[model samples]
Target: MKTSSPSDAPRPGHSSVAALLQSQGALIALVSILLFGALRYDNFIGWQNVSDVLSNSSKFGLIAVGMAFVIMSGGIDLSVGTVAVLSSVLAARYSNYGIAPGIAAGIVVGLLAGLVNGVLIARFRLMPFIVTLCTYIAARGLALIISDRQTVSISYEHGFDTVGQGDFLALPIPLWIAAAIVLAGALLLRYARFGRAVLAVGGNEEAARLMGLPVVKVKIGVYVISGALAGLAGVIVASQTSGSPTEGVGWELIAIASVVVGGTLLTGGQGSVLNTVTGVLLLSVILNLINFENGYTGGAHLTLGSYWQTIARGLFLLAVILLQSRLARRSP
Candidate 1:
């Protein structure tokens, strides 16, 4: 038997602390922010304000859930945002047909875009970053073309707008939809063999392949799922805003930032849908706070402009990335 020195042994409590930081850090931060906002603002804790945060966060939360899956599978989908825009354009165009057809068309568009990405990456063995980046541009162009570079409004008479605006069980329709997606995602990731394969592939593709895992299939499947969710998000967005080809601009960065803030490794192989939801709420709350701050100081020399929100987002991204780097180093 080989004798090991104390220095070589795992540090007691370190693993637990790191795990806590990785898993619950975003939750902690979100709670702190909520407390701060409630204390700092007279109306931040009101039901109306709370509802706004939850409802607005749902759209990004849906996208972030998909992003968590892709990032966990060691891949990225830059096209998700523009793909969403394209889906929204399609949904608006088809809204006159009926709500069912409109929703189906939007989702199908997303699925098709995802399929192209999956084929390029899994079949052609292209880099995910490059493939998704190209698709991102293409999707944006397609959205612009389909909508004639304009906002397409959905007719309210058809009830198509209810998808985003309606309430279920006293919760916003988008929040209900988002909750369902998150629950389904959590189950699939925690209890499915496909989910295991995803983790294995992300952890080490070559090793997973050698172990007889369906690496290619898993890789392709994650993108498909991501695409489908993004599409659903697009439909919700279209319903909420009537419709717009220009929507979802820069949403990809927001999704990525949410994932990172949620403690998902950019290198992949570890993450949680629940944590990603927390991250979405955190970002949403920050933006909402900025809005409140701006309103409170309106017409004042010290007013924090909308640009301050952008700067704050960038800084938050930087801080999360740094934290991720440090956590990676500390992990055994």
Candidate 2:
């Protein structure tokens, strides 16, 4: 037998290093931010601060989970945020008609928007980017029209307010809702046949189709699901804010960043929903820590504000893209 080289041994050290970089970016980021905040601010880790972070995380967390599903299916949904805004507007409009109708209207709008995106991409072979962009604009315009460019308040609806604003054992209802969604998403991704079809299609559409997968239906379904989740998030935000159409602008970017930062590939096919949850929590914690630290430093919380968060998220996307590109190059 040929003599074994030192490099051929198991390379445990190298493997560990690779695993760390591959799976721990969000965790590392979370830890670094926590340590920095704890050192820089005395109250950063207090229960109040912890609650604040989770509350903030719930909103984008829900959106990010849905976006994860869409991204995993080899697509994107630029329209999610705008569709959310549109749904919120509709929700507020129908609140006077009763809670059931309002809730129904919001979900229906979301599903319809997703259907538009899915049909365009799956059936017409249109690019997801262009299709979603068009829907984004259309949704925003529709929202503005419905609200008459005004803010509609739903403070009178006790049930609606409870969905968005109530607390459960001292935690916001949205957090519980988000956690449930995350768990459901994990199950779907891990065990559902439809979920497997999504992964297969994303991995190689031609091969997946050749293997008799319902590639087109799965693609469309995920987009629809993504839109529905976004819509649900909008309703929650509206309830939390006491009903506001302006709640969802720019949220799509945050959702996209959370999904990507959590290790979901923009190129699609491989990622974990649970990892995406970690990514959302990490960002939320970092931003909350920044605000807490800013107060200690005697700086305005609104000064640099979320601008730094946006910058950090962009850098994260760039880094993951570079790292993944390297992995792809080395794979052959």
Candidate 3:
């Protein structure tokens, strides 16, 4: 009888405490930041600020959710940010036609880009990093070509801008959209067959193949998802502001950071969508606190806004990563 080694094959819900901490660590950090901000700044926790934070984080949320799935599949997507840039430009350029057409155009751009990536990686067996990097460059160039190197402005007659600006039940529409996406992602990862296959593939591609799991299909599927979501994020960006080929530069780092901070292992397999969302919020809150700090300092260091944000986000992410390592070691 070949018995499964406990270390090699953990049962479901194994190391519940460690798992709990790994998932909840970001939540705890977010709460701590909020409390600290509240104590130091007037109206720091005000509803208006809260709403704005949610709205601002929504774009990253969409991208990050897709990123989490890709990471869980033991792959990476450097093209997502640029794909979003392409989608935003497409969305803006098509806005004059009508809302539905504009939205469709953006989604189509994303879908097509994702399909290319999927085909290249899964079919050709190319390195995901290289394939996505090529896309990162190609998408940006395409966006620039389409927009004539200018921001693609949207016509407001179709009210397509409502996606980024409108409110629903007193909350931002973007928030609702992001929330819906997050919920769907969580449900799919938690209960769907495709989700299980994804985990299996990430856990061990060769073993998953031996078990008759469709490894090619899953790989292609994840890239498509990452590309499509990135495109959707671009649409949101165009709606909120304008689409520029330069918009999503370095944004992929944000998605990777969010995934990592949320306890999604870089090595793949184990992850949580909800925790990824928490990571997004946590980073957003950290940026918000930076703004609050500047205000408290009377804007004496306003010039350091971007630099400070990078520093703060980096430090927080580092902390979460360290915490994740510790918790992983503690897990049985």
Candidate 4:
């Protein structure tokens, strides 16, 4: 019998690097922004400004947290934003249907969307890219059709305001919910048997199947989870705005960017929910800084606006992929 050396058995040296990146990427990025802003702008790190960033980031954080699971399972879901729009619209319609039906309708629609993706990917072995892209188009079109290409306002729904405007411990209800979901997701992914199953399936599907893991089921399960969360995010967004199908374009890109920036492997298998959370915050923070600085400067810097953010996201993704490729080549 032969035993592997302690150093060779997933020791502290290399493992910590990924962990650090996941846990502190946002904080480090935040610090970097402050340092840069402090040198460049007069009021980059003000208190109200910080809150604004976190507040704005929370919505994207909700979707990114869900996207983390999908990406970790070696899959993608481009339809999340549209599903969210569809769900939010349904939620508003449900207001007429009553609260229970509204919530149920929204959740069911999202679950069904996930089901479609999961079935195609797991049972039919379709590529995640094509499947999700089709759903993206389908879901967005369906949302437009249902809403008649108009925003459906749910201001009349009883307690509708509470869903988005309520507070918990001095934080917004949506933020609290996001935090709770993140905690739950982190726990499930890190400590549960199901979590390991997800990781194994993503890391090596054939091996997971050989080990008797329910690979198909796990993959399907993650898509469902992702869809459900996306739907929930939509509901929250609708609640905040009192309208549906109005603000859900390009959200998938934001979610995907956060997932990648969070340290999740684009190839799948290696990542963490916490990292995704940080990534979302990091992005939100940068955008917040941009907005704050712009406000002070009279919005003269349109170049530092959403377009710049998109370019930053692309550059960050390219950098991470290249770094990972180099590291993979160096590793055993």
Q: Best by TM-score, which number?
A: 1
lDDT of 4 by residue, 1-332 (tens): 98888765655666677556444555566577778777666656666566556666667887898788888888988989999899988887776756566667777888889888998999999999999999999988888899988888775547775777677676777777788899999999999988888888888889999999999999999898888888887777767774455568889988998887777877778788988887787677666656656666644454466787667756765665455455554444
Candidate 2 Cα deviation (angstroms), residue 73: 1.1
Off by more than 4 A, model 1: 1-10, 297-302
RMSD (CA, Å), each prediction: 2.7, 3.5, 4.1, 4.6
Rank candidates, lDDT, best first.
3, 1, 2, 4
Of the two candidates 3 and 4, the one with more favorable TM-score, higher being better, is: 3
The most accurate candidate by lDDT is 3
Tell me the TM-score of each prediction against the true structure. 0.93, 0.89, 0.92, 0.85
Runs in model 2 with CA error above 4 Å? 1-10, 297-309, 316-332
Candidate 1 lDDT, 1-332, residue by residue in tens: 98999997668688667667667777877788889878777799898899978988887988898888889999999999999999988887788888898899889998888888988999999999999999999999998888888998986778898998999888899999999999999899899998888888888889999999998889889899888888988998888885687788899888998998888888787888888888888899888877777776434433566787789867875776677567656756
Stretches of candidate 3 exceeding 4 Å from the true structure: 1-17, 297-304
- Candidate 2 residues 164-239, lDDT tens each? 7789998888889899999999999999998899888888899999999999999999999998988887777666
How high is the lDDT of residue 161 in model 3? Answer: 96
Candidate 4 deviates by what RMSD? 4.6
In order, candidate lDDTs are 0.85, 0.81, 0.89, 0.78
Error of 1 at 96 (Å): 0.8
